[model samples]
Target: MSLVPDILLTGAGAFILVSLVIVFRVVRGPTMQDRVIAVNAIGTNIVVVLALVAAATGNRAALDIAIVYALLNFLMSIAISKFTVERGGVL
Candidate 1:
């Protein structure tokens, strides 16, 4: 049992914990913005996990996916904001 694997596993566990918290917020928050924030946080955490897994496994494809995810997150956020404003602030 090396410390490296333990550290990696700990990182993953932390990701899971944060993801759970975000999910809870997304599900129970009274405001749409709160849910959006939680969703964005989840996307960020997913990108981080993708990068970590890529580094640990020496997989190049994971890095590409992470990059795509990052771009998609940004685009989605922008689109959502525009839609919200156009919809007169309703979700």
Candidate 2:
């Protein structure tokens, strides 16, 4: 029998659904900044999903991976933002 909590499953499912909605923004954003923000949101959602999975499965290793992924996501957003801001000195 599985011991995973329902709340964790629900949270993960919700985040996945939100991420799917964000995909439309990533594909159809009116500006580069908007697309970048959507990508960042998707990355953040993935991190949350990882954390929820770790909590449900009692896998401490997944939590460590989530931390690393979060750091990379933050760095990626900053780098993309800088790139967009400096393209011809404006995006």
Listed in order, each prediction's TM-score against the native is 0.86, 0.89
Model 2 alpha-carbon drift over 4 Å, by segment: 1-4, 89-91
**lDDT tens readout by residue for model 1, 1-91:** 4466557657966997889878999999887777788888899988988887776666899889999999999888888877777988874
Question: How large is the C-alpha RMSD of every model relative to the true structure?
Answer: 2.2, 1.9
lDDT of each residue in 1-91, candidate 2, tens digit only: 4656578979999999999999999999988888988999999999999999899988999999999999999999899888877885353
lDDT score for residue 46 of model 2: 94
Model 2 lDDT vs. the true structure? 0.91
The lDDT of each candidate is: 0.83, 0.91
Clashing pairs in 1: none
Prediction-by-prediction clash tally: 0, 0
- Superposed model 1: Cα runs more than 4 Å off: 1-6
